[model samples]
Target: MAQPKYRTHVGMVDILPGEVEKWQAVERIIHEEAKKFNFEEIRTPILEQTELIARGIGQLTDIVSKEMFAFERGDDQYVLRPECTAPVVRAFVGHHLEQRGGTQNLYYIGPMFRAEKPQKGRQRQFHQFGAEILGSDDPIADVECMAFMISVYDRVGISNMSLKINSVGDPESREAYKQALIDYFTPHKDELSEVSQNRLEKNPLRILDSKEEEDQPFIEDAPVIGDFLNEESSQHYAKVKQYLNELGISYEEDPHLVRGLDYYTRTAFELISPDLGAQDALAGGGRYDLLVEEVGGQPTPAVGFAAGIERLLLACKEMDIELSEPKSVDLYIVTIGDKARSWAIQQLPEFRKKGFSATMDYAGRSIKSQMKDADRENARYTIIVGENELNEGKFTFRDMEASEENQLPLDEIYGRLKKKL
Candidate 1:
């Protein structure tokens, strides 16, 4: 038989044991910071009807058009959600949550999917920690959401980020601005990429978000959306900025900062870390006044943001933020003879039941080798259960750090370690 070929997986990743501690630390900070703002956790399925994303997230945008992992089941096509907001809106409306609501503050942390080329801080399967406030149009709500994102970064010790803000206006104002973009980009259509050209005809506003360097000057000189904002939208945006100013939150207005989603209107902002090379955004979101209604709900105005966990972690590394290393084993039980090995194994369940993390060497190594292994585990203490010690109903407790060893009765071991932990 020809030699069997083994191929490694592509476009997918498995987070291994070493990376898990970083993920846990990130989740801990996210949960702690979100709770401080009274944001309740909300979870939506990974699979959503394809149209839900197509309609709400914009079929023209990269997420819905190119990146969505869509598959068909029976008659309906479903997508592994590339973003959180659309599915959340579907859950909010389908459950009729607004009927009971003054306003709902919701947060979510989980995996999201996109079929894109994986790069540093950009993966096909990645995680996001996001918070959303539904059924409120108050600009303070916008500021609060921005502040919450900033607080998470600060808590994680990520620093020196720039906040970029923009206003795309409400329906009426945007309709006028769209025409201006179409007129400007229409003349320069041949000079633009095929994707930009298509966007120019369909949703011209998306042209502002194009990263093509050749497209920059034309995009920059294009009419500002703020100038075309209607009175209500202009005031809404102004009030959001006023709240940011009063709270001493600094931000720069970027006319091109329209977030890449169909739902966003009025305020849009992104917290970016420049140290992250090309994919610099750590977190970004904006006001979505039409999102609830877009997903077949009654007219509801909502605003929220999603922060990329991987990007945030990258920012932490770039900033040299010292994340705590994973908590060490409370105690490691080292055994010599076969009898002591069996005894140590039985004692593990008891130690863990009492809320202490305990482990024993299963390899049946020599007593000296086991002690070395305990040291490698960064164990607070090691219990040596040699034949002699086991016969005496006692074990030698060696403090891994202090190089101190003392004998203690097996009955008193759990109690003694509990205090040390």
Candidate 2:
């Protein structure tokens, strides 16, 4: 019988070198944009207490009830993070990050796990890069967060994208709207999808964002949250829109843009690209003022967004945007004979120490074969060391691109390559 070949787990992918380069390019833009906005990077664990996510993301949401990868270990129940915001908040409160009492601007880039069925641009094990600003409820914070997110997408050269904004309103107003959604959805109970019907009783706002074909007609006619916003929430939403307008940023108002998570309160937004069909969102987030207190921190207001790295890359591919390729080695050293091979081994570190990417043959291949490898790697220069050259204290340097060769003394080789590089 033949043995089974190993394969990558379903919904999980191995990011090989060529594809990883594109991911790195996107991450570079994220880091650069985050730095420009004065947001520091923060890394949190992938695993957290199950209760944290259940409470933070809400028991009623699909992420907490249906998607989370959770299990019990001994006496403790833990879960792989389905999203970043809840874990970020857990870290913030657990570490007492708010002890200083000022706004905390933090960013993260890492893998997030969920158990959802995979589709184009959606996966169970995926990556997210996002920012969270804790301790500020001011409308300017919301505006700046959106601006920073848009700037990242702009820097990445992704086009044909649109920003949709909405305000779910404060807790009081949100509750009133929830009741309104219940009233509207209850009439169409038998027509609602099984998933949406469950959400109708648990969290009716989620039904508005549902992808169910059967529920769209009813959701389209449902009452808009904007109509029910309280005075303060309404003014806050207006100021956010005004700031976006003054910044020359264009956006469309989306009354049904309630985010997937239950913690979000006011200022919900999503950036969608036409390239991704069906699952069109490239990134989304909103204000979550009550989450901090729910997770055992003091009442702190915050807003932020997270973009899927894979989805962003997908958009780039659809638009034919070229990402940066990794640079090749500066030199490939080819050696002949025992003395030359030993010398090449010793000199390899010297070349690298001077900031040159240098590689040499370790498989004891022929000089001709090593030269072929050098060409395949696109090495700029190839150094040939032989018995004669070792005895003469000189080396032969060939410029691969120009097809030029020079015989330089051992000490002069470094200077010559440094100048060329």
Candidate 3:
């Protein structure tokens, strides 16, 4: 094989053939399960206003500050969306989806762009699918969102995943907590990593989720968010756990489990898969009750979760869960001689119009080679178009799987194929 003149950019992948089957398999499960939970699929443009992402995800957040693929042209600024939940909410508020609705349950599946260097399961251009239940503040709504998050993994045969849950508390509680974190870490600021140092004053809660080795010592002793939760936030957080327990969804409480994003509040959860090795997180999501109101809508409450499609499929592969087999063609047309080739090309569409997946030799290869092609493609049946069969007004149809051949007219072949199918 010759190398192509072009290649995919860094931090990207070509999900060709065998691997794409797994993606399709996973995607189908996602659609079916999402619909089962009353999630309406919504597609937003991959390009969004830069301000929307900065404002929605928070300016101090890593995604907005470091990982965003954004640009400014003239007076206008545009960005490739780094996450879906924010864009979904933007569309909801922009399109007035609330007017005709009650608790709009929307879901999205598409690619997101970030400027970060790619790793095993992380990509600069990665795909994510998530569900957002807007207009509900009930902790049971939080429980349902979390359940929906793990439903795909449950059905897809992935195993050995740990559910880690935490509460960042609401705004009022979070403010006092931020001050506590600032005061606690301020003295040790010089000893912390640059990232952690920057986060100390702007948003101290982010330091808790830092991955820096040096920062870990300081983060280890920092105050937990649960300690600062007010009466209302504490009640809401307790209800979320109660519901999870009732559903038999076992979870471990983590003090520093604040998700990477700044929008999350009250409830946060991560599904960890040991199969992923170093980058072991399967998915992370939490409550963002202030998101809708932040985006110029009324003070509507919402909860959502986002999972990396690449990461999920990676986990499936690591666990040796066979998602799908190689796709096989229904019919392969093996043509010999000029006249027979013409006849095959003419009738191929008719076969397809009637819903048969048919393919033919455009190379005009030898009959021997054409037959080999049919075998290679794993075709279920091979129809030989040749002088003898063409003159007899019948075709040599061979059942590739059975290694049996028979002389059959077109209608008979169609009938037999339909019956077998």
Candidate 4:
């Protein structure tokens, strides 16, 4: 026997029938919550210029340096975007969305590609639903962004998640903290991992974001960004906490919580859930006032967060949250006898045109097997067509849940379904 030569990629997933229902439920809630926050949806292409990612996400960051799936085609280099914020900003700038006038609250739902060691929930091709607020530097904008994120999970019914927040300060204090980090880690340089050793002079904050076990010791004892927050940033950070408090949103201040991206400034946060084993972060985002300028736009303030839909489904499963399924079959038609089959097939489109989700067996299955299909599909009603019904000038319609059957003319069958179902 020749084995199948093709298979799904290692870190990719197929959202199949039974499982896709959960995705539908989660996405429904995401859309509903985003609507309440007044965030309109924006979609950017999955493929973006490789240089856009490298320049916007930062060359020193792990996403651009190691994980990007880049290729050169003709005169241009392209990458399957590892994240959406940069591209959203690029569209905002390139298309001049600012002409629309107010601070735009944009949300997106799509797949983001990144090559990483595949794990449960965190896949190479993962779906994310995130919202970004452009043109507002107000600390309230940051609080609202976090609140919007928290509200999405709340509506999703995924409990036991904690919000952890911090401030990276602005550029000046960030620079001060980098120097302080260099001073502190220079002595223990030999104990650091080669990656940390390489990142020390270029961007030491990324070293703090490292996952290498060997780098943890120095990372733990390193100077915290809180200690380096300049007065203006200190006020900004205080305002974010105060707003969160005013709105009754609880959070824990985490000094070491610098986001993984380089453009982040001022506020940073993560939503952590114990449902994910080692990598507990369910979502993370922060303020990136410099990202618009970094992506070729006029300097604009933005705040957003991205959460993995796969991880969210896992978390829902762990919490025992019930996910509602999508619409089931409204009508299943079972035809017997060649003449009745021919007649039923002709009527199928008519039933559908009357706003019923109707389907039938074209494979000439037995009545018993056709009825089984109706039951498996959770059909609300099943209509039986046969020589007896054709001769009687009526059809046999069954209320599947109540086990009641009635003989009615074609128009009356539609009336009964419309009235009762």
Shift in Å, residue 23, candidate 3: 1.6
Q: List TM-score per model, in order.
A: 0.96, 0.97, 0.96, 0.95
Off by over 4 Å in 2: 1-4
Question: For residues 140-199, what per-residue lDDT tens digits would candidate 1 score against the true structure?
Answer: 889999999999988888767999998989988888988988887888889987778888
Residue pairs in steric clash, candidate 4? Answer: none
lDDT of 3 by residue, 143-234 (tens): 88889989999999987898999998988888888899998999998999998888888878888878789998888899888888988988
Ranked candidates (lDDT, high to low): 2, 4, 3, 1
User: What is the lDDT of every predicted structure here?
Assistant: 0.86, 0.90, 0.89, 0.89
Worst 10 residues of 1 by lDDT: 6-15
TM for candidate 3 is 0.96
Better of 1 and 3 by lDDT: 3
